[model samples]
Target: MSLPELLLAGFLLLSVLGALLLSLPIAAEQPLNWHQALFTATSAVTVTGLGVVDTSSLSLFGQLVVLGLIQVGGLGFMTCAAMMMVLLGMRLPLYQKRLISESLEHTSFAELAQMVRLVVGFALATELAGTLLLSLVWMPEHGVAAGLWISAFHAISAFNNAGFSLWPDSLAREVADPLVNGVISLLFIVGGLGFVVIAELANWRPGRGLSLHARITLHASGGLILAAMACVLLFEWDNPATLGGLEGLGAKLQAAWFQAVTPRTAGFNTLDIGAMTTPSALLTMLWMFIGAGSGSTASGIKVTTFMVLLLVARAFLKGQARPVAFGRSLSARTVMEAVAVALAGMLLVFGCLLALTITEPGQDFLGLAFESVSAFATVGLSRGVTAELSASGQLVLIATMLLGRVGPISLGYLLATRKTESLRFAEGRVHVG
Candidate 1:
């Protein structure tokens, strides 16, 4: 099958699995329908945090099912399948290799199998370290087993940028807990940093330098995170509803930092997101739209795409013919693709927002728009509008989440695979402004 077909099939299979799991007697009390199961499955698989139902209410088995889906989704279905195939002594076909490469966002097929192994190993190591640190923080309050489970679940969720929380209010209730907030934020930052960059950094030699892709990913990601932190701090510094009323400097700083980092496709939030002012909410919407790196579990158009678009704008302002970044020239195709993706993403968000406005007429426009963008980008931050959305609004969000996770461009590619013939027509020029 083609890459698009493979992805769609994988999504469908995972959705079916979730539905089946939810149908089991132990999992049936909170019985999920096809739409809910499909939405949750896609959200987990895409590492998107938009959920039609509260995860905390699910039974242990159901929660485990969600966790399992997250694990498979974070690694990509094809990668897991490829590994299984290898274990069975089955050689990967060229098409399968290509599908895996695209799924992992790798540029080439060379050493892909080895890369998959490294990816899984590195993911586990990071998740384990995060879990250990989190467990230390949670053990005193919740005791050993409960703390361990919370730690492990959160570690996986944070590292995967999946945002599946055991608590209904998410990490908001633990905002004052420095250890919990700090550890979770650290995990989120590490996870949001693309896997390729991590792998490259791990294998880096003293004299050797980072690859171009690694440098771009790191620099762009760092710049965005720092900017987001500054923006959120400045915007919410005096807002009594958010960071203003806090007496302790440490708590305010921790909350600000956590909020800043989490919006970049990490769904955990220390502050009550719904209480933020219009300006802060707008800033968050922009951050959510930009999101994390390409190959990471984090979604959105990606930091690289945002950077490329900025470079393109800069080139135009400077009267340059080509866009350049990090001492390297960007190709025309790259710029075009970036523009297309951004435009498509914006349109999707706006479209969903419009749908939401009609469905949830009483909702705040700004908050609804922010929620729509968050869902479309798979960033999962909300202005407390998600739980309050009507059934139609929920359906709109579900579609947006799926489109965001699968990607608008990928969906377009899937829908129209046949290339149109370019028959040369009579050349004509029209006068323009």
Candidate 2:
């Protein structure tokens, strides 16, 4: 098996084992069914945040198991394994390094070890900072110990874009607290920005412009976040179900901004997502589907794919022969891969949506579609179907979450097994419409 595939398999296997372990009486008051355990395990390992049951209801032991799975899944199993190998004073086998490279989406092994070290360091630093900031807001409500745990859990969840909240209602209760909202939102933004983007920004040298990849990621992600914020504000400004009922204009704006930013894979909701207007929901779906950047904990087709597609379209519109971005010509192969990834992702969402609609015919189509898209994108913003999905519906979401985590293209690669070429095909002419 290819290194990526092996790594993914190992992760799935570990998740199942973890879930089984969590199902023991010692882990929970009530034993969970195999399906429930598998689903929860997959969701946590994938960082998709779709829970079949209320996470807050789980025993402390069970919750810790889930949190551990999220941490392993967020950084990737292979990545953590590599770190462990390094800590043991063992050199990573060339094969293992290649696997690590694929798992982290790096192009080379030149600095693979350093990159892994950097990823772990930056991730821990950001999460710790986030926890300290959030503790200031959470400590008054909960005691020191509980507050510290809450802060740490949320910090890891936000920085990893895991979206598993300790509160049953997620972060909706904190909408009015500007400090909490601002800190969490900042963590979400930083996490969703992709590690490579942040690393490049951190090591950026003055007078040496950003790399093409970094530039595309930054511009596309920034544009989408701003556009989503504006659209949410415009569509829900007067909607009572969402931000409209807030007492102050500043609170409303803050809530809108937070909602717009978090849905792009962080999955933390500061407002009633189910109460959002159809237009706002639709806009949020778009943002989630175009999610964070490639190689990040966040999923979806990725910001880079959307940016590449846009560049391709722009080139075609201007009658240019080649697609170029930031004065760098994009490889044809990259454009094709982006198109393939997007097509595969959309197909998966559509297929899952169809299955969900059939399984639950009485539910709202828009709501079902939203849930399917959320699962497929690994964005986790749902309109309350998560707790209500039937066995079949849950299975559909499980498949979507797996595809989202492994990537649609990666799954396709596994299935296809081999690429086909045609050099002797006869060309045929057809009439234009």
Candidate 3:
């Protein structure tokens, strides 16, 4: 099978396996029907945190299963499979190399296995740090055992960008708590930077700088995060239901910061997302659609894609021959691939929204659009429409989640296609609007 097909099949199989396990009576505190199990499993496998059922209601075993699913999902099944292969002293085939190359957004596979090893170790170390830091806050409040569990779970979820919270309101109690807010926002930020960028940055010296791709990803991601934060703070500065509900400037700013970054595909909400102002919600939708870096746990068109489009637009205005960034000219193929990825993402969200319009005619366009973008981006930040949706709507989201996880990779494959020319064709010109 092609890379796209393989990815689709593998993710589907994992989702089904997860669903079957979650459906077991031992998995949940209450009986879990097939639909609920399937939806939860799909969400977990996709690393999208949208949940129809509250995660706190699940038994320990079920939560563990979800955590395991998030780890594998965040790391990509093919990466895990490659790790096992490396452990067994097996060499990767051409196909495996290609998959890893594309999935990790690496230009080549010279150090592929080494990079994968670093990825695993980095994830383990980061999650451990987050767990310990979070334990400091929750252990005092929830008691040692429960606090430890919550810390570990949140660390994993936050690092994976899974956004699954055992608490019903999702860290709402800790909006003003600096420890919880800081650690989580940082975790997701690193998680969403893409493993390749992390690995490269880890080995860097101050004067040595970094590669073009790494630089672009970092600069663009940082800019977007700051921009999103500013927008949210401005739009929600006086919304009584959101930022305004807090006590003081310190708490409000902290809440604003957390809420701002969450929509960068983190999904955890410090504020009541449903009660957010229309402008704030719309700004969040835009940030969620922009999403995190490629090969990261968080998903959307990706930071690189967003940057490429901006560069392309700038080049167009300047009448340049090609899109250039960081003093390097990007090939036409790369720009086209970026365009395809963004276009595919938009189409997927729009198609899901259209279907949802039929399945849920009661909700307004903004709510459904937010939900659709959230699902399609795998951001998992919903606006209270998820729980109220019908079974059909849930299925629509399931498909959308799968598409979110698989769609960009598939589009990547599509963009890689090279059509050989047997003869030259006449030049055709079209009018611009």
TM-scores for every predicted model = 0.92, 0.94, 0.97
lDDT of 2: 0.83
- Relative to the true structure, how large is the alpha-carbon lDDT of every model? 0.80, 0.83, 0.90
Find the candidate with the highest TM-score and give its number: 3
Any runs in candidate 3 off by more than 4 Å, and if so which?
Answer: none
Model 2 lDDT tens row, 261-336: 8877988898898999999988888888988977788889889989889999999889998899878898877788
The C-alpha local distance difference test score for the whole of candidate 3 amounts to 0.90
Candidates ranked by lDDT: 3, 2, 1
The count of backbone overlaps in candidate 3 is: 0
Q: Write the per-residue lDDT of candidate 3 for residues 134-247, one digit (tens) a residue.
A: 999989989999999999999999999989999889989999999899999999999999988898889998889798889999999888878878987898888888888889
| TM-score, structure 1 vs. true | 0.92
- For residue 141, give model 2's deviation from the true position in Å: 1.8
Where model 1 places Cα greater than 4 Å from the true spot, the runs are: 23-25, 28-38, 408-433
